[model samples]
Target: MRLAFNNFISIYQGLSREIWVLSVVSLINRIGAMVIPFLSIYLADAKGFTLAEIGWVMSSFGVGSLIGSWLGGKLTDKFGFYPIIIFSLFTSGIGLILLKELDTFYEICGGFFLVTLFTDILRPPIFVAIRQYSSEKNRTKSITLIRLAINLGFSAGPATGGLLIATWGYTSLFWVDGVSCILALLIFVLAIQPKKKIVEENDDSLEENKKSQSPYRDFPYLLFILSMVFFGVIFMQYFSTVPLFYKEVHELNEAVIGLLLSSNGFVIFLLEMPLIHWVEKQKKYSTMQIMMSSIVLVLLSYILLIVGHDLWVLFIGMMLLTLGEMLMFPLSNAEAMSRASGKYQGDYMALYTIAFSISHLVGHNLGMQSVNIFGYNYTWTFMIAGLLLCIVLLQLFQFSKKREELSQTAK
Candidate 1:
């Protein structure tokens, strides 16, 4: 146990102080990420909306996210990450606080859209910041550390949000979430100053050549992005429709549901860094192979739900899903970062984030509507089919990347 603990501690040794500070900021911000997880439930219980209606409102959040991510990426490239990150944090906090005031269906939709717009604008800049702060060798580990912090906060947030909902009601969640964002903003501003300019190690000609190539023109990367869209769609079901399944099918309550969801975060927090470190040390499996295996785990997770209705099934399924998440996210992030070139890092990261935004736009509505119309088992089956497709895409991307590498070698 001591040996294992020391090994675990070793993975964190080389990360820069700025990366740690960013992780801390993410922790603070995500700790208040209480609203979105329970938003569907709140809509159903408090607003008396139909599942279909709730899906639409949730999709509005996706729409806003899509726009915000695109805008943020462009703005980050033009204005730099510092100003964009600060602006997003401050505006998003105010939006979240104001979100609690809306009661009507349309009002709620617009509110969610506006709030998520500002919130998601934070993604590309943050990704760029991570790249700037980390060395290539430690980049994936750094990303995992940040994810660990986010998951830790998520674990605390939902568990606390559940209690808050039980006592003070859902309104309390919004206030807490909003306040946390502002607090995170203050911490970020006080701790980290802006860099004057990004310094790249690539020669001018190579850098210029890379800067001229748009991500949209990269076929293999596009396939990878599409796979992420499918992955996001599959993973996002847990946030939107899965809770409803627990409530209606398993007959679980708000607090219990919160605990179950929080368990994903907790599991990731405990295991991700070590697991990532171990994975990095292994030369036997390629990153794509690891990602494919992770997808299989997620696929099996849904299959478990299809086969069993027991509470234990939920826990086991969550464990599988969390394991898959731990494997998939950091590696995928590294892949995206690797693809990014000089002057276009924001563009690359934006497209990567946009995949999830598209998933948000499409996934929640699809999950909820499928559940409303076809029932939970069918929804799970549908998601399994989607994962299968995603796996195929990843394989194709891997093949294409290998072919490209071989061609370059021959040259």
Candidate 2:
């Protein structure tokens, strides 16, 4: 027990004050993340939108997210991380507040798009800030710290949002979400410096960094980003398909589905840090290896679902899925950072963030389309094929990254 406690503490030690502040900001924003999770239901029940309308509204959010990430990356590169992040937070807060007044389908859709745009615009800057704040050794740990805060808030958000909706109604959710974003902005303004200046290295390093800035020029990194998109697509099924599966197959109610889904966040909050620390402490497994293991776990989780229809089986599958998420995301962030030069970190992270955005658009369609056309049993089988392809892509990415590093060093 003493050894275990020390190990957990070790994971958090030596992180910079800036990273801690960012994590706090993340926690604050996510705690009031009452809008998005319940947005579909709110539109359907409160606003009287048809299923097709809800889908269009949600797709608009995803499209806005993709553009927001790209725009944020460029802005962060030119103006630095602080301004873009602050602007995004403030924009999202104001947008969400305005969203409550919009009743028409088009108005609501536009409002939601703007809200998601700003919210996603905040992401790449956070990654850029993490790279700026942490040393090489603590890179993965820092990203994991932010993720820890996110999961912590995710675990709490829906439960509190549910209560707020019950007591004060859906508009309260938007108000609270907006207020939380502004509160996060206040924390940022008070605690963090307004600008992050890029530290200069030697001329050769500067040239290399500049060259790496354009992601389109880096073929290997592009392939790696593709792998990330695939990973994200498969992982997103947990959100898109798993709930529907539980409903249709097991006849689980909303309460049960919510409980089952929330467990993913709870388990990550409880165990992710310790698990990450333990993995990093081990010298044998590389970041790629850890990622591959995560992929395998996700694959197995889906396989579990394919075999069993019981609630316990669903719980087990979700547990595996949670563990896979904890292992994959921070490690992938670290890998992406490692491959990027300092000047291009924002662009690299932006492209990485876009993969998730793409998955948000694709995962649901993949799940629903497959299930509709082929049935649930075959849908899981199709996902297994996708996971296998991701494994191959990850392996190739690792090889390509190593080769690029060797070529750079030989110069």
Query: What's the lDDT for residue 189 in model 2?
Result: 88
Worst 10 residues of 1 by lDDT: 201-210
**Per-candidate local distance difference test:** 0.89, 0.86
Which pairs clash inside model 1?
Answer: none
Per-residue alpha-carbon lDDT of candidate 2 for residues 69-91, written as tens digits (9 for 90 to 100): 98888888777889999999999
What is candidate 1's lDDT per residue for 1-411, written digit by digit as tens? Answer: 999789778889999988999999999898888897798899999999998899788778778989999988888888888999999999999988998889999999999988888998899999999988888889999999888888788777877999999999999998989999999999899999998877665554434655777788878889999999999999999988998989998899998897888888777877899899899999998898999999999999999888867888899999999999999999999999877777678888999999988987888778978998999999999999999999999999988877766665565
Provide the lDDT at 124 for model 2. 87
All candidates: CA RMSD in angstroms? 3.1, 2.1
Give the Å error, residue 297, model 1: 1.5
TM-score of each: 0.87, 0.94
Clashing pairs in 2: none
